[model samples]
Target: MDEIKILFLSHTVDYSKAPYDTGNQFIQALRNNNAAYLSYVQLYNKYGHYGAHHYLKKYVRDNGINCLIYGSSPSEFYFDINYLEKLRKEVFLVMMTGDTEYYYEIRDQYYAQAMDLVTVNDFISTFKLRQIGINSIPYYAYYDSTKYSKNGNLAKDIDVSFIGTLHGGAGRWHNIMHLSANGINIETFGSDSPNGRITFEKKIEIINRSKINLDFSGVSGKTRLTRKHQIYKRMKQIKGKVFEYTMCGSFALCEYAPGLEYFFEVGKEIDIFHDKEELLEKIKYYLAHEEEREKIAQKGYERALKDYAVERAVPKLISIIDGLRKTKTYKPSEIYLDEEFIRNYTTYRTLLIIRFITQLKFKFAFEELKIILKYRKLDLYQIVIFFKEEILDMFPRIKSVLKSIFRRQ
Candidate 1:
């Protein structure tokens, strides 16, 4: 039998000083399994949206890639459905997402319908997608055990620590502040924290050193206007950090999210809190009871190592992928991409282009422009319509006046 040639497309660069992030670890897992001839292409930041899709299709055809795994995100919007439909015939295409809670309705579901299989990070999302007739499976986030493991020598001085960005109005700041106000000596280390962003090694070190590493399942604050309904909603999901914290042999006090119990036994392997009061109570109990804390952490670490380590998880994923390839059928859905949806999508893409240009990212802006021109075919009428909406969006007064005028008409 010929070796299954797989092309993994994702953004691999660690924007921070971290040597390697999750994407790199995932690729390493595939290689370690020796399941297929894996080839990687750094998408998004490297090639923009349209460029990434164009390059991906060409790469797959040229390199005989029978399996294509896309680390899908909402950052890039230029994935032409027609293009995906054609490519699905050639390769067993799969889409993986960790933030399905936020993007599922706005972006992911449309793309997922075109995929041969969809792997989600949370069980609830898996169930939701499957209910809707999509071939979805629970693929929990795995960690590099080499980097994230128990360091017995490191002293657990920090009582509690949260190591992630605090931008999302998803109540992370509120939670941290609430804990601190109630006399919990909490330390935060992320983009908006006092410590700012730290290296990947530093993150792992902190996790190992902290008595209780905090994990918030809330989505990031990077949602679009169309997705405003999700803003500050604090809809929790099974985050990757849940595994990352436990894998370091550290006690993880996570915000309770539905379907988290499927991954770890709450209060046995790990612990969770639903509200601020519960979280505060748990922290106090855990802090005083050092032996109990350590026991839970140890059990969590053992579970993570045995089940969620990249080495163990990847092989299972490959087996599932193989089985899926043999049995799954391609059924593309086009109902979601109506004329109104296209206009909204194009407007969002235009916003991204404007943002890129303002940030002096000319290459990305140019790439977006090229794709918009080619696919959208924006003529005088469409351009006029876009700018009018853009103008109305920018000025509330203008929108009111326009509405009043239309109403008078």
Candidate 2:
């Protein structure tokens, strides 16, 4: 059999600032298992759409790559839809998103229409994409057990722990803060945490040592929208941390969500809580009963090893790409040049143009403000305060401006 040539593309967003990441791991998994020949591409931070297209086309031709895979991205500030449409006839395109709830403001709608196969973690996002005629699969988060495994030497001494941004959880952070205030000791780490940005290996150690690992999937404070700020709506699926905690042989108490039941045996394999009271109660109970916690942790580890490990999940991804290739054959350039494609492509391009203009508007506005501040002879402290308020006030206006423009069109 001829080797399958796959091109893996990902934006730079690493939890661990390692040279290799999940995209590389996926490629490694395929090659390690004698499944495919892969080329990895990390989109350059400074490259524009034209540069990206130029490099991508050259690489694909040079390597004879037949499939393209896009991994998790921190932001979707740039994309080339026309280039993707042109390449669609020659290669199968797959997009994967590990994030579903928080940082959702960064997702691009154009991605749903461009890729041949889309794999998202949550059912809600999958449903939303499928409604737009996209082929979306609910591929839950997976872990490489080799990177995250139980260390016997690490003592399980911590009572409860959470590892993530504290500012983004909306109502959930308030509950955690309340716990901290009430004298219930909880270890934490992340950007918002006092200790600040622990290493991925240290994170695994913390998880293994803690009795219960708290995981939350809630709205971020990025937008000024009141609903995202005030509401405590539960996300429909489990977060990536759930898989990591479970894979590392740690007991997790995640925020209750609908689709988690499909992955785990719930109370048997993993624990979940709906509200602050339940979460606190579970943490207290589990801390006292080390034997029970260990039993649940072992079960979670078994489940993760059997089904959610990268070694197992990568093969399934390969099979899905195979089926996609078989089912979706395309004509040479004609499909992209057709009326439907033209209409869709026009709208997609228009959206990109509008986004570019809005970004430019924000840039010019900030520059003008800086000039005015310089001329006005404003002090540094005054300028800083004014600039902060301007940023906070300008973003919502920028969003509204874009919404109105799109609505008018």
Candidate 3:
């Protein structure tokens, strides 16, 4: 039988209008090649929060799930657990140890249950897993490199560019200080900049043009439960943005991490530094050696396309699932019928309430709905009309909706 691949559970805003949305980009890359029997379902939670954990299990049985992955892209902020109850398949948690120790405990518990654990580094709790006899692997977080190109001439209009929060904490302040003290021509950008956020392509262009783009991560430890201002500090696991910079053919001078040496040969693939001094020295050397710098950028670009894309990463997950099938220890996932009923209740409730109120309002009496529907396409009016017809058949129970929406409620 062919293997099934599901890129599971995303929490991101839509990006149809935005030039770049990382979650949307990930889904795009994973679906790009049409590799495996690939499909996707966005995560759901009740109360407009993360859905029940058991719901995932049931969805699997109904849909015939063969694999599940917790997509571990970086977050500018942390959110609460919402959809744990619905998850059923043996999971693969792709965690990168950063400033937050949020999932450290649950990660160990899940690993103990024969589920595979994938982290970017050999973290502290990772070692503990092996001490107690658990199997896990290091899966490098990947980026879609093809989108970025190494066109002629680097655009260095902006010197010493930086992205990310400016005032999330002290680390950001430190990054600003490091670049300024070095006296490299640099421009500060991101949340710390006058207005936060930049376009994905604009970000890439900025890095390509700048001599060195600073990549620094920030974390606040007080997770509504702590005394320490900075909780967990593992500066090594630099993620998607690093690959992004490289793929654009821009040289990155980033913090040192263990496995990074494998992807990048310290002085070659890109540059790294222990502290402010070491980083400054390398930047000066590379600025003088443009040829060497370009060579390194090309090398990093090659490596990124080869190893850090969806084509390179998805197969690893598939193989692990096949190995698990040989062991055959899991109970097939199952979801109760009420879950579907609840979904129906949830989906239509908000849509109907808004639609009905609009129809019944004086605007229908006062003017054309189109004047108020400027932003909303309301392309699904046919579907809404059909549904409201059903409610209309049921009588006064839904009469309020019609009065409001149709100006009759």
Candidate 4:
């Protein structure tokens, strides 16, 4: 069969790493799938996407783009509707990221209006979208472990080393406390996860050198303590880290969650933890049982090569999209909504507005009021992601305030 010409639109070209990113996954997948001309579309240099949404028309029209796979971002929602109408048969689908409410503004309005189906990277999130009356397909970004297989060798230099982020949240603190208290001599080999604090090569080095490489998925805050929806993606979404760890022949110690079984036969390929007591106990037992650990790692390595290749998975992704296009024609529903509600009330923007108004009204109590109000209703992870992106800008300004900011990036 002739390869499909598909243009993928993403907010990012890459997430800068193997475990949590889609870029490496897609590039390798296309190669494995023998996908002809699997071009990825990103809008960093070609002007802001809102503007490119207009210009992309000319580009899409000129190029024989058989199918359009749109990715997430508030600005990258709209396509060249005018040109798409002209080549009405060409643009096949729109894949929107529905993980956060950042896209929710135009989700029901413009996004669902532009494409055939919704694609959620998280299976649990996809089910949530379906539960809330929106139809979506669950798509997981996979890995081509050929590279890892080539470099998979355990040289006993480090006993236990972690290459993920080690700052933020109670879990992060817990990790720090445990590592410190245990005196396991475990090096915080990589920077931090939240801040994306490690290099890809460094990751391989850490896994290769360390006998016991940690794979804690972190806690997905529950409904009583936190909203289930937000926690679901954090814990349930099978990260490439899980597979990457397995592929590198590192003995993984992970938390039990959805989609894990898809990769490994828990306790065989990877060891899982249920609680702190179980985790510490398992780590001790596995460290002692060198032969058993090696056997499990070898098993995981075989399984990763056999089951979790880019070629095997990418076709599955395309097939899901193809199936969606087949079952339901890509007729986007035109929607109308109040512009006021969709207003971009960014965290910085809101603070700026508040600061300007407060300075004019009162100066003495404004600082106190601002401090009290800022913590009242902001999603913590949003703050973290935002800080990670704009840390340089915010660093200088808030250096005095965030004295103990433990950023690993």
Using all chains and alpha carbons, the TM-scores for the candidates as numbered come to 0.78, 0.70, 0.63, 0.65
- For candidate 1, write residues 1-409 as lDDT tens digits: 3456676665555636546677778877876765233323245446667666677778788888878887755534556666777789888888888667766666677777677888987677787788777788888755889878778899999999998887654778888899989999999998679999888778889999999888887766654433446453757777888899988899999998888998899989999998888889999999999999999999999999988988888887887787777765666555346554455456556755655665577888887776667658333444455456655676889899888899788
List residue ranges in candidate 4 displaced over 4 A: 1-3, 11-25, 28-51, 73-90, 96-115, 132-137, 142-146, 150-153, 179-185, 192-199, 219-238, 331-341, 345-409
Clashes in each model (backbone N, CA, C under 3 Å)? 0, 0, 31, 3
**Which structure is stronger by TM-score: 1 or 3?**
1
lDDT of 2 at 383: 34
Model 1 quality (TM-score): 0.78
Which run of 10 residues does model 1 get worst, by summed lDDT?
A: 35-44
lDDT of each: 0.75, 0.66, 0.51, 0.54
Better of 2 and 4 by TM-score: 2
Which 10-residue window of candidate 2 scores lowest in summed lDDT?
A: 333-342
What would you estimate as the lDDT of candidate 2?
A: 0.66
lDDT of 2 by residue, 336-370 (tens): 23332223333333333333344564443343344
Instruction: Please report the TM-score between candidate 2 and the true structure.
Output: 0.70
- Give me the displacement of residue 41 in model 4, in angstroms: 8.5
Candidate 3 C-alpha RMSD relative to the actual structure: 13.0
- lDDT at 112 for candidate 2? 51
Q: Give a tens-digit lDDT track for model 3, residues 240-274.
A: 55677777777777766545576667677787776
Q: Rank the candidates by lDDT, best first.
A: 1, 2, 4, 3
- Give Cα distance to truth, residue 360, candidate 3, Å: 21
TM-score of 3: 0.63
Error of 3 at 362 (Å): 31
lDDT, model 2, position 303: 91
For model 4, residues 225-274, the per-residue Cα lDDT tens digits are 13324633344334456677777777777766565665579878888876
